[model samples]
Target chain A: MANVLIYANQQGGNLSSNAREALAFGSSLARSANGETAAVLIGPGAGTAAKEAIAFGAEKAYTIDSPLLAQYQVELYLDAISEAFEKSQSTILVLPFDRKGKDLIGRLATRSSASALTEVIDFKVEEGTVHYVRPIYGDKAYGEYTINRKKAVIGIRPKSHEPASRDENRTGDIIPLKIDLSEEVIVSTLAEKIESALSGVRLEDARIIVSGGRGLGGPEGFDELEALANVLGGAVGASRAACDAGWVPTSFQVGQTGAVVAPDLYIAVGISGASQHLSGITNAKTVVAINHDSEAPIFKRANLGVVADYMSVIPALTKALKKRMGVNTG
Target chain B: MHIVVCLKQVLDPELPPRYFKIDPETNRPDDGVADMVMDSYAENALETAIQLRDKIGGATVTALCLGDEDSEDVLRRALSFTADRAVRVWEDEWENLDGQAVGHILARTIQSFGGADLVLTGYQASDIEEGLVGPVLAEELGIPCVTLASELAVEGSILKATCEAENGYQVIDVPSPAVFTIVSSEKNVPRLPKVKDIRLSRSKPIEELEADDLEIDAERCQPAVALRKVYVPDREVACEFLVGEDGPELASGLAGKLMELKVL
Candidate 1:
């Protein structure tokens, strides 16, 4: 039986959206396998978050609430998660492939001796075994894999699955797991969690993005991109090259190793599309490229391509956009 | 401080997309199309290790890998640029091992080395991109793991790493004998090997190891995850080029099309 346990993490007294997505996903997968979906919500707001998990379709919610479990110290979190896994007797575990998931999953799977699957975008269940599909070669190809072991731990790629819709009337069991944390030893206290710490529209939340690249040559071009982004009410993003050259903060980088964004409109300015950058925009609804190189690989993925110098093109585009949108500039 | 950096030779990720192909029988990237190169992330890990070693004063960086003879080239590359020693662990019959199995072999190999102060690896390999090795290795060794570090520091046996988060980064501190999976940053971009160093690396002996040498569980090394199939995902978008008399005209035309499509 595919009893799936999802770590429905909460932030600011509510179940985070990604965790909801995971719970929704686990519920669907469990139903397919004729099993149940349970969520382990840890720390301060976990009791409240448990209801949210049920709203998102979890059949059972395992709450591990402790003031000591407040912050996400990996060792403490891992211990609690392990306790929930055992008590719930789940065969499969699912977590969102976010920053904390990357930190905790390997250890969790290792402790349980479960097969670890990373960044899976698709999955299939046949004869009670799960098969996973993940992007490889920077999303140039897809590879499908199945776990031979009965126990499996999966890290679901963020934004790959839609957020689970909520139903307030949906009810389920809430099991509060009693766990001992008095003996857990951790050498490190993670240097505090600073929420987002970004000004204006956060890149992850941004619907429209104006991203620059090495082709900008220097930091000044980002100023123009910033101006355009400002008028369009979007976030500014950079490629690894631009960020590497010290033109922008590494946080602004949009690539495989950087922030993965799924914006509604992505404008690539002066960027020669590399797969690392291409992978980040896989979910973008519309891609527009403005580059001098006509043969830049980005053109293949761009919905609209313009071969030109971004310096002249960006200013014109901004002005044209203002005129087209009927926005008055005094 | 003694740091061991795990390296893997993979299909050159920078190869043109059109040249990419998978051999149906083997379900592996066609070796004919792409030459194997040191994984980009491994190079960053090596660079990060070397930098940390330099900071720690009189430290050694050992290069480790689990691959065939062709894998030695990457070890040599590591030797050329700051790695003090090189080791290769492989079995003749071992082919297409999953990340968990590879992690087992690596953990056993490290155990044979009597352990070290730190272990470093790339966040993930470019080919399979599993990213399970570093954390799994840490688990097998019963040590802590801090992953995706953009910057690392060694201060009196405690290792401090600045790791990437969603919108910001975190500074995590772990004690000695821990695992670190490095992510590339401007601060850790790999440095090139000098010609003299490259020539000297060719003469340096690469210590070869087998499953028996480390007493690894050969049967247990079997893949936890098995590859079912390999296929290319079609993501082609027909692009419409905007031509104009000048830059302004092109911009205006592009803007008009976007509006028509209701993209903005």
Candidate 2:
């Protein structure tokens, strides 16, 4: 039976949504493989996150409760994760494919001599072997592979799987893990963290998104899109072009090199779809395009298309949406 | 000081849908249907190396790629960006290598060249998007690694990087002989190659080696990933046009339709 271990992400004492999602995915994988699932949560909140892991689905949790883990330092976290992996003695490892994971996946795999598959979207079991599927070619294509190695580390893409249901009544074990977080181990030191000015619902978790593009003349265009987004209770996104033009933060960019989102409703304003941009929203359920050019490539993939300038269109659309939804209008 | 930059040649990511054909037998993109170019992020890494080399006097940038003969084009492109040397590593029938295999080959190659003070790679390949090679290579060479970095600074015998994280960004400092995977940005875009540099790039010689020369066992040198299938997903949806007389009417039409469908 495969023993699956998850490197659960947690800070001070709060477990991240990504960790919850991973616990759910990893637990299900273990059960399907006729194995057990466990998680290693590192930080001041390790104890709390361990219990949550059990409620979410893991059978046992390993904890490395150190204030040093309150912030994610790659070298320290990697050392803690590798230690947890060794203690768990699991053949399979899973972690959220997030900002920190992109750094740890390869290093962890090499340290343990395990083969890795990153940003996996799906997996299947056949005769006790796991076959993995992931997006490749900028989401234009998908690749499925069977690992030839004995040990495998998989990085699950964000929002690819449902977060696990909680059952606080379920019983599980919590085991504390020991690791030295001293100054000598600082091969890579996180010197400082600069906060971004972005404030709103995160793009990945939003159900509806109102995205602007370069077609909107300048920064003024985003202000218009924000009005529509507010009326619809949605987050704001931007094409790479808009982000490149310094009209929006790079965090707002939804494209191949930016955030890959799968919101339920994605509204494109003044955006002529590029292949890379389209790839990011491939999983978005319903797409609405409003562009002045009827021949814009976005029309092909959009569920609803409107030919109009966003300058005039956004105000009317926001007004209409606010009216229909009974939103507050000053 | 020596800096090594890793580059990759991939199918054009911007190819129109009409040219996106998959080979029925191999489940891979149909050969010769789409033009190939240097992976754009690698260009960012190359640019970062060249810029840093300029900032630090007497430093050389080496461009390295692992692919078929066509991959040489990326090396030449790197040369156009002022890379001092280039190395191409490949072998007959060595396709679809897993990240570990590629890491092993590259780590050995860097060791053969006596290593470098800094090794830079594109944060992730545009095609696979796994981004394993840099860290794996660093681990293989027993050095530290930093990924998803947007900028780099060289202090007095120290290297610092600015990398993105959730809700913000972080600056990390490490010693030399480190690996860094760089992300692309419009602010630090790759510069256009000059005609004089293009001529000089053609005059430079590329060091080529076979996968066998790395001394990896034959069993370990086989195709890295055993792919069960590779298929393009159909993500298109039918479009309902909202025709109107003016911009306001069109906007209203779209809003009304969305409300009717309960999309808002």
lDDT by residue (tens digit), candidate 1, A172-206: 99989898886356866576444554558988889
Q: Which portions of model 1 miss their true places by more than 4 Å?
A: A126-129, A192-198, A326-330, B261-263
- Per-prediction DockQ, in order? 0.71, 0.69
Candidate 2 residue lDDT tens string, A38-138 = 99988888898889888888899999998878777778888899888988999889998888888899889878877788888788887777778888887
Estimate every model's Cα lDDT from 0 to 1. 0.86, 0.84
- Model 2: per-residue Cα lDDT over B1-264, one tens digit each: 999998888888777666777787977787576888988778889999999999998999999999988888999999999899999998867777877778777888888789899999888887777888899889888899998787899998789998777765788899998999987765557899999999999989999988656756565455445778888888777899988888778877887788766555
Q: Please give the TM-score for the first chain of candidate 1.
A: 0.94
- i-RMSD values for every candidate model: 1.8, 1.9
Prediction-by-prediction clash tally = 0, 2
Measured by lDDT, the strongest candidate is: 1
TM-score of 2: 0.94
